[model samples]
Target: MEASELRRAVEAGRATASELGLDVDDVVVVHDSDRVALHLVPCGVLARVAPLGHLAASEFEVEVARRLADGDAPVAELDPRVESRVHVRDAFAVSLWTYYEPVGSEIASTDYADALLRHHAALRQVDLDAPHFTDRVALALREVNDREHSPELPEPDRRLLSDTLGGLGAAVGTDRADDQLLHGEPHPGNLLNTRRGPLFVDLATCCRGPVEFDLAHAPDDVAQHYRGADHGLLHRCRALNWAMFSAWRWRRVDHMPDRDHWRVEGLNRVRAALDRCGPGRPEAGGAGTPVG
Candidate 1:
């Protein structure tokens, strides 16, 4: 998350867009996280630029967008001006996406839920070569277990992440007969209340998991509206999500905004969720306790 790295990513986006015959002169940095999302002015294209190391993730997302669009799912479309694919330039990976003008700060919970439900229904038809949800947990688990990578992470918190990731991964990993392709994270951040309609973005997080696992990323109001979700499974997934987040916050290489604040908050959330865990799965009839 260095400025220089983002500069390179922006350069990559501009260079690739120029090659594609988009009169890209000025670019605006809309977001800076694992990737630098640049708004290519005049062309109205949102180029999500990241390091070359993220090529696999970007490529997978591009394919997801294309397939979802084919299925008529509510996803942010890839830039159709050029071929729908990831463009690499100057050792960076660039994917051009349709930049929707933000119509509001947020969308209604029901709208968000319905849009995600539509995506889930459409996702059932997609069979991309993506990893399972636990596969991602395994990645975070490695970060927690590697002391050299997270030397400052206290042993107790490390142990918490290790156990939660391992146990919940097993609990949710068993019996995938009903699992479907999920948006990885269908949270509000990924849900854009655009002038066109409700659309979801950031498809790289797509994974094979139960619907509750995807619902866990959403707000409680949203989860309440998502049809037929297993409350018990949602609880486990919420806790596991917090653990994975904690692992990332504690990673030495992660420098996301407000690291200290979120790290503490996420740890507290994990503890509260674990405290709510029962000897057996709670009767699956009621809404899960607010997890965030």
Candidate 2:
């Protein structure tokens, strides 16, 4: 819903705070991409309300936050100073959290690397029999590959994407197991700057799969985020992931041109990463390769 429309809905009784268990005394609307919801409460309560599927991403985010706060993981956990709750109502899911004031600057790549390394270190202590990375790669690949010839897309672009996927297939191979849980979409936007450091916000796409698949999405979205100085396995995986994103973007032109532009740009970036890395060094450019 447009900002105006959502506000109108909230005011017209079409969307009531009580319906979402909100007190309705104070109300605010927040929109991120395709998701839209409200932030409101009574004297001491605060909550965010949005449609069901739109809020699914919150699932993974809350889990990650909880783990981090418990000292089990270290990727900038949410502040313990506030309490949070998630509510699912009919077609909507509302996450009510004590709005926290940022205690630090935005999380940078170095911070992410350190946190991720520690997280993996702790993960090693447990048996994370995650699924084969190939499953996710294949699913992401299909989101773009199957739509290669959608008459609406330019033929040359389609051909280039097809070739790119062909290269990805030969390089990534396949995976069968589905054990490791991953934040399927890990962009800067999903991360929030909070008192604790960088609190990750969306996790609706978290899936049990190989860790490499999660990392690969980074470089693919370089425009949306920067990898900074980290150049290890995760970085390599991120580069290759961009290549896959390129393939996906190249195939997404049929629907809304204005809306799909960013995806297209992302795909182009992945293509650039692939060219730089080449087919041989799956880790060099943004070629899809499973990370361990």
Candidate 3:
């Protein structure tokens, strides 16, 4: 939506903003992604609003606000003096929050690794079913698993689909940690480089699931992309998720060329996981194969 339309919405109270007791000036739209991220400058408060598309989850934004309100220690945000809130702007899915001047980096130089561990640890607070990641996975599997689609799929993608379905079933079945929380889509882009050190943004996909599902993104890979540093964990999970998530993404946007790569990568992830778990696990179909 246009800034003028959004401004009118805010003015009409169709959307909510802080009652800061001040008159506002012009609204500046800051493009973070294709559809969202905007800046609104008033006399006193500067607002940063992000309107997410359907692909992004609203629960993540809600969780961020909740955590901030709860005073979750790790979440460094704008100055406390400048408060923020997450509100739905439209059916298109947008989060309206205030802008905060960066005080430091998103990741602490001395404590980056520890901060990641802690951040992953905190994801346990989200809802698994309400946000419904598992259902999404299941739907993706159903779409590709059908014989009509499988035969037409490239060899790499075919195997990737077969493997992802099998792997998810195995992970859930053996997951002794039944109720693990996850930052469904944690990545470096979601994190902000602020003055306070490694502040997290883009809580649009914060929900509960297997830690592996969240860790699947691999912080090291994101770090490498952003900082050009080596991180084994990040690399491993990046590859793993690349393998698996493609099936899900394909289910949503099947026409994309990247789907081919995702399928191949997924097969590799399956191979790695199977090597670790051994042949004891059953395949997605009735067929059996070597564990290693």
Candidate 4:
């Protein structure tokens, strides 16, 4: 996921698009971290060009987006210029999507909450055979447990990760009444403020969990407008989210943005969050778990 690797992935996406009969004059790197996202010129298409290892997740995203769009949900859509599926080229797996020309930079809290609730409402009713939140916990547990993935992780850090994942995983699992499809990680990064409104992208993180799980990823102020979301649950979920992402950052091959900084900052972040969730209320992070 370095710059050169990103260029290669973009090449794969460009080659794939050409093979698919789409016209592409140029390529813009929308973002490049764990994966390379591209904005194909003239085509008005956004391409998520990732390693072939992520093919399954890419496929899952396409299916989920199609279903959500069918339900009239506020989500980014698959590009009409190409087939609605994951396209492959060389070592990369590509999924083309409709690119919304960003209308504004900042998102109001009310607007953010409104879009999230609508997304949750549409996701709740969908009957997709997706993974539960425990699956994500299991993945994090395995990552920290396996030295191959996290060789330099200190023993104490490993223990912390396990404790957080175990406790929060159990907590999220204990209450199943509110379980439903969620955006998995609906942080601000995933939301696009377009003229049509805030449309969510990256359905690859979709999973079955409580609405609070999704709310945990949003800003604290946005939760106030969500009305019925369990505040306690959201707090626990936020801690869990930190742990989950912390484990990822610590992984040996994790190329997410600010890798060196986040690897340390993220684990410390989880430790601090865990202190807030202790004893009688000690907390909480999910999905057939994608090992991301």
Candidate 5:
């Protein structure tokens, strides 16, 4: 929704604002895409709005945030004053959050790793029904296979992605023995350095998977600090991550100009990783083994 439209929606939903004890002065569009985040200043609340169909996932995130908050985990805290229930305004589902100022500095690998490990530990204690990591891979594969949605992807790359996803899915089932709760995508971009220290945002992607799957999205130094991570599994997970995200980017390439570059780079990485461990390759066994 545009800022003007969102403002009107917020105005129409004054009952929601009152329920949250928010005295909204103004609404600034902080981020706009599949989800829209509006900064409600003076009220100090961030309103995140997504499609109405996303209510379940949005509620899941709030629950996760609530659990993490109880344990003092390094994650963005949900506003307790407001019920975390999804507020429906027309076609959009809105949720309110406590706003914090971004530090705007690059976080160190050690700091990022520490926060991630702490959050992961806390997440392990919470039991919530979330999609498995493979579900996401399957979704990406479906998108790639959908000719109407992915007309931009070349036929050869689509075949490569299908084959790669199949191999990676089988490898994950056979290789990973330490599957657990994960932050899904704990890269530096998702870690916001606030006064409360590095807090994780965007809990929408939380899933159950190999810890290595989470590390696959982190920097090498961050992964190294996550002691006992199987490097070989991490490598395979990284390749799978690249393939999945690459497919997702490709699916949206027509809508996002900047994604074109990253999509190509990610596809190249996926191709290289697949070639190394694909059937008949010397490194085929490497996918299931621990790195020396």
Candidate 6:
């Protein structure tokens, strides 16, 4: 969406800028994608708009942010003055948040690991209606099955992914009994290092699952810092994460040249997981050898 169209949408969708205690003097497009983020000038607030289907996920993040704000967990807090409710306008859902300057320096893995642990602890205290980790895999499987949506994916790779996802589903279902609140994806892209500290953003993927699910997306050093993580589960989760991400990229491969590399990387991870957890290896629980 264009800046002008986004501004107009925000204006039409929610309370007036004055009522919401925002400065409407200037609006700049800070980021745009599936979600459009507008920087509300002078007020130092960001207005994020997304499709109405994202309403549930958006609200879930807001609630998680609220909970984290009260705890010692480091997280980007929602704008206190502005209500965090998902406001629906036309075909979009909007929410307001406080803007923070990027720290600019690379965040150390230890920092991310410690912050994630704290955030996970805080998240465990809050009970909200959200999808389980398996739901994510199921969603990805549906996308992989929908050839029309991801026509860019080769027939061979698509079939491979479909079979891989099915095996992953069974493996995760049988082995993972412990569930905890997860950040869903805790990679560097989602971390905003600010003056306060490395505060996590993009909580739309929050769900209940094993910590390994989250670690799959994190760096090795970060995972090392996080004590008591099961190496086997972490490996399995890594493959699952890669597969789901590859399914998403399959739909956008036409527009994203870099997606080809990611697709290969994801497939490689799947192969590794199968090798480690192939059938008859009781130690590898939940995964079987790759089958054509």
The CA lDDT of each predicted structure is: 0.84, 0.48, 0.48, 0.84, 0.75, 0.74
lDDT for model 3, on a 0 to 1 scale? 0.48
- The per-prediction CA RMSD against the true structure, in angstroms, equals 4.3, 7.1, 7.4, 5.0, 5.1, 4.5
lDDT of 5 by residue, 23-115 (tens): 877777777666777777677787877777787777887777877777857888766677766687776678888888898788888888889
- Which stretches in model 2 have alpha-carbon errors above 4 Å? 2-24, 41-50, 53-69, 74-86, 103-106, 119-136, 145-151, 163-170, 173-179, 208-212, 217-236, 243-264, 281-292
* Candidate number achieving the greatest lDDT relative to the actual structure: 1
Residues forming the 10-long window of minimal summed lDDT in candidate 6? 280-289
Candidate 1 Cα outliers beyond 4 Å, as residue runs: 280-292
Error of 3 at 101 (Å): 4.6
What TM-score goes with each of the models?
Answer: 0.93, 0.62, 0.59, 0.90, 0.87, 0.84
Instruction: Write the number of the candidate with greater TM-score, choosing between 3 and 5.
Output: 5
Give per-residue CA lDDT, model 3, range 4-88, as digits (tens).
6565444422233444443455555454332445444563233344344442454445446566445353554432443344445
Query: How much is the lDDT of residue 139 in candidate 3?
Result: 57
Please identify which of the two predictions, 2 or 4, would achieve the higher TM-score against the true structure.
Answer: 4
Q: Rank order by TM-score, top first?
A: 1, 4, 5, 6, 2, 3
Model 6 has how many clashing residue pairs? Answer: 1
Q: For all candidates, what are the clash counts?
A: 0, 20, 21, 5, 0, 1
Report the error of model 2 at residue 125, Å: 6.8
Candidate 1: C-alpha lDDT: 0.84
Per residue, candidate 6 scores C-alpha lDDT tens digits across 146-212 of 9888887777677667876777666775654688888888888778899999988888888878988
Ranking by lDDT: 1, 4, 5, 6, 3, 2
Candidate achieving the largest TM-score: 1
